[model samples]
Target chain A: MAHILLIDDDAGLVDANKLVLEAKGHEVSVAYTGDDAWKLLEKRRPDLLVMDVMMEEFTSGFELARDVSIKFPDMPVLMLTGVQEHMRSDWKFDEDKDADWLPVRKFLAKPIPPTKLAEEIEAALKAAKEKKGKRPS
Target chain B: MAVSEKLKVIVCDDEPKMCSAIKIILDGFRPEVRTLGVEAELEVSLVSTGEELLTRMETDPADLVLLDYKLPGISGMDILGRFSEEKRETAVIIMTAYANIETAIQATRLGSFDFLAKPCTPEEVRYTVKKAAHHLIVSRHARLLAQEKKRIRFQFISVLAHELKAPINTFDAYLDVMRDMTLGKDMTAYAGIIAKCSERTDGMRKMIADLLDLTRIESGQFRRAPAALEVAGALAAAAEGVAAEAARRGIKLETEGAGLLVEADPSEVGMILNNLFTNAVKYNRDGGLVRASAAADGGKVRITVEDTGIGMEKKDAARLFSEFVRIKNRATIGIPGSGLGLAIARKLALQAGGDIEVESEPGKGSRFTLSLPAPGSIDLKAA
Candidate 1:
């Protein structure tokens, strides 16, 4: 089972996602705010980070993702957002916004299903493993 | 809707006396006009700087902003530029003690509602404010009407594209099959070429159909006929429809949740499943797997199509369901598509009181799930 970090501001949504991930036999860590998520990352890095775009402040998740990527380039981030289409088409994340930020690995819109989430996590883990193999140890 | 409520006004002038003079004039005219005139609840707040005016507008979004032409930090024209760029729909009246015709023309160009000379009368302030409010109402309504018209035009174009392309695509596919030994000729040498052409043509056909469906639904022409359907049976048929194409690509198509039931339009549901499956196969790596599964959960059934294909970038994945939007990185240019399939499927799912979702990553794979109400369970009357 993979260790996953799920960050979101909605308490009920976080709880629902935790239950779903746990039921699938994955170890899940929940963070209700971006600060908590940053603190968690400082301790032990998760296998994958599932975060929401709109948080307590504007672009909180985006800023956190940028910091994480800067510190640890290997970690993969999966962004969840309701305004995915708007962000993708209209917003341009350039060097001025965040220097170390790489494109997120996956994006799932709000009201996602448990099975699809599980599938994405599994696929991402597999891809990470393949990348690790190719890297010079 | 009472007329006694005072007209809230915000006055920004470096000279405090000028603001007081304007307020006094407005207060004097309040009692004289009673019938066919607004009972002026004229509350004026005076600010000395343009920055303060901007802050107040951001905080309260006042009904009207009376701005002085000259200010310490930012000029009235600069404020007007920012307000217009932000699309703030507030009535703005420019006031200047030293008035020039060029300044008045420039203020009007910058979208100032009206230009006023300083030491003006109370009647003029009242008339300008009233006229500006009326203009605001009319402009807002006009904008709404224009948006409605644009939406209608988008739907019309989508439908027209679909209606024009369907029959042509069908004919193209037939010609492709006939060119090879798949149907009539025993010419085995050109089988590969014929298969590729046919596949591309089929993709185009599906795209046209998607455009047509999107237009119909957006224009309220498409209607949902929810009925009890064997979910497994529908999956089987849709799979069968794409089986030959999958075989051509050496992809495996499998279904797990047969015999389940769902409440939806059979044709629309089938199209949704078919589009997802086809996308999986067409975009997959050689020998990739395409799996379709369904499960019953309380009052709904969840159907999913999972594939090991050339996945998408996160940005592209976000717009996977918007009409006529395709991922530029994953698009195979020679392979024809109108990029309306997922969007149409999403609309259909919503019409059935359900939703469609996707999960994907670059070079990994993708999965699409459809959550729908179970057949024979939904109350048609309430929905």
Candidate 2:
């Protein structure tokens, strides 16, 4: 079981996703605003984070993800959005840029199937675990 | 009979006599309009302040406003500024007794529809109002046309994005699947999937080709080379292209009533049939039956494709011939298609002096019928 944080401005989507993720045995915490998400991050870190593109302030999620990755580089971030293509174009996917940059582990377009979401979450968790194991003790 | 409609007007002036004179002129004009059997009833409202004029506008919208240039709290130009800011559709005609040419120019800059000098004739007032009404009508229509064009452009961009993304994403997914050996070295199964993916890619290519072709045809860049051909052979070949896909899904694809001849470009006819057959297989239920047939009827050859798949609702069926409209179906998700097949096919058929018809219901599936002129009826050699 994994503890996942979902940050999005859409209240209904947050509730629905929380229900689905919890039902799959993952403990899900949701933040409808970017400030609330930042507070939650300071308190406790989750194994994975799912974020939306547009929040109260435009591109708030993108900014928060970058900050969180700098503070806690180990945590895997899964970015989800309706405008995946738009985001993909804006963020120019590349790994060699900067360490402060939040390397988005995965991206799922909105209205994603529950099965696909679960699969992606599991894959990301497993990869994180293997990378930790490879690190010097 | 056409002249009884009320002429709604708003009069803004600090002076009571100016308002009274304008009201008297309009009231007298109303009776003359009625006598001429014109639908013009004059309804006027008087306001002393610009604020009152703006507030009254919310409840009682007028067709025209007679605004005084000199007023108490706010001038006529100030009211015009408010009108411009509020984006009011009503036309404003500036009224100035001590007409300073400068104030009239300022009023014009502030968007006054027209300017009226003091002690103006009732004839001038009547003619000005009539011209303002005509101007309003023409401007409203132009705005509507501009808005419609913007809406169409937005729709085209949305469709273009979907059309481009679907094929590219499908190609990427298929390439990933092939590279990973997700499906084992069972060459037959591997070959089948690859073939299906390639066919879908081909469909995308053809849709792009058709889009370009239609653009060319509409721009008068394309000329047809029509020929007398066997309709059955062309349709059969198109059906064969999608036969493997149907078979894979356990659907029965059959052709009947062969040996029909038509006067058309064989390649174009084949393309139309290919699109129809692809749609039939793409939208059909697993184990569905698709039948393609052609027959000579009256002076034309009728080719029909009937499928037992997920049918379209009446609303969708109505727009089937329109460009870039895909029937929303659960089974069609993740499948790559531009939704241009039927539109292109219809255009091709029309160019060949033919027409297409569709009969469909939400759950029962659909039948597309194409009617084309019989072979040798039209001069195919020069086409």
Candidate 3:
């Protein structure tokens, strides 16, 4: 089980996601804004970060993601956004762009199902472990 | 200066011959008024009284007026005062046979463009008309430009307001579902419903925030807090941001070439980096690789992101950086994007004396290179 940090402004959604993530046997902590997320980050490094794109400030998650990757290179981020629903488009996330800009591993549309969230979290942890194996000694 | 081609010049006098003489001189004399690729010509209208001139003005305002101080049924001075009160654009040239220093001073005080005595030379009539017409054209152009700016601003605000419909509608739908709840009274059984409600509301909150950010950027009010920082920190921060998403998709996100210093606000630079990095992750193949590496190219420092994912056609890539444009493709149809990310990224990059460049091909991978001004190199303007 991996440690997860969930940052979102909605208390209800945070509680729901926490319940779902914990049910999958992982440790979870939550913050409601980018500032609070940073304060939480100062205390511990989570294995993965689950974030909302628009919170307190638009693109705040993107900012937090940037800070996390720089401060904790090993932590992975899963971005949940409603941006797609409002600005519908045929656009795929491209990683070849600087990691600093598109720092999240996945851009999942919000109102996501609990099963899918848990599954993605599991997949992320597995990938992290595999990445550690491939790193240079 | 060329006179306005359809310039209307009104001549008011109780004496028909006086009006006729002025009309004939103006009709033959073309006023020189500067215009933007448009010729100007004087079209004269003769009125026997101040009331007649004012009535005609109500329907078709003159660009310039030639009025006699004495008239029946309302003095020319009263008409001039009315024009002043109404703030008409028509430039006035006062003409009276009883011209005196006091009357001339009064016409000037009332904002008349020119003052002339009766039986004035035709040359004097022509020159005054020319000066007044030129002033009219310049003010007209200024008004047009201001109106156009207001119209564009209104359109932008409307589009932003329209965008609010999505979240509100989604919330409406969520409420409808809640109204028909079949589960027990305990809220745990309604966790999903509660979650959905929060999601919609959160979406609205986010949309509003993005709108505010766009406004700040466009208004030129976004102040920068530039500091000397390491490019590696930005890279690592970005990598950390997408680590989960990349890992979930089995995509490899690796950052190389650490310790390159750049003069930038970490958050601003981080924003650019996060956008590109997120794009790389979201568009990649299930097991593809995304590599972000920083290097110095001449006097500039660049962080290049290369992805082995489903790329784009050159045509689609060309439109990617424009505001509200999103590439429609089979591979991207299910993806959720604000469509403003790249546009915002490009703006912030340019403001920082840098730019984000893209090279992609269908079925192949894509490469994005972001270049920033190196510290002590390239004069950074206050943005």
Maximum-lDDT candidate: 3
Best by DockQ: 2
- DockQ scores of all models, one per candidate: 0.02, 0.04, 0.02
Every model's Cα RMSD, please? 17.1, 12.4, 17.9
Runs with alpha carbons beyond 4 Å of true place in candidate 3: A1-137, B1-59, B66-75, B82-87, B95-101, B108-142, B181-199, B218-221, B226-233, B254-264, B292-334, B337-340, B354-371, B374-383
Residue B89 shift from truth in candidate 1, angstroms:
12
TM-score to native of every candidate shown: 0.43, 0.53, 0.55
Which one wins on TM-score? 3
Where does candidate 1 chain B have its weakest 10-residue lDDT segment?
A: B176-185
Worst 10 residues of 3 chain B by lDDT: B173-182
TM-scores for chain B, in order? 0.55, 0.60, 0.68
Supply candidate 1's per-residue lDDT for B364.
78
Instruction: State the TM-score for model 1.
Output: 0.43
Per-residue alpha-carbon lDDT of candidate 2 for residues B1-383, written as tens digits (9 for 90 to 100): 45455657899988888888888877756433323344455688898878788788888888789998888877788888988998888899998888888988888888899999987998898788777756655565578899999999887776677566644544554454445444555666457556656766686787788788668766756566677788767877887999899999998988875667888877778878988999889888899999988888887989899999778778778888988776543344435566777888898899888999999876678899998889767766544
Judge candidate 2 against the unseen true structure and give its global Cα lDDT, from 0 to 1.
Answer: 0.76
Q: Judging by TM-score, tell me the better candidate of 2 and 3.
A: 3
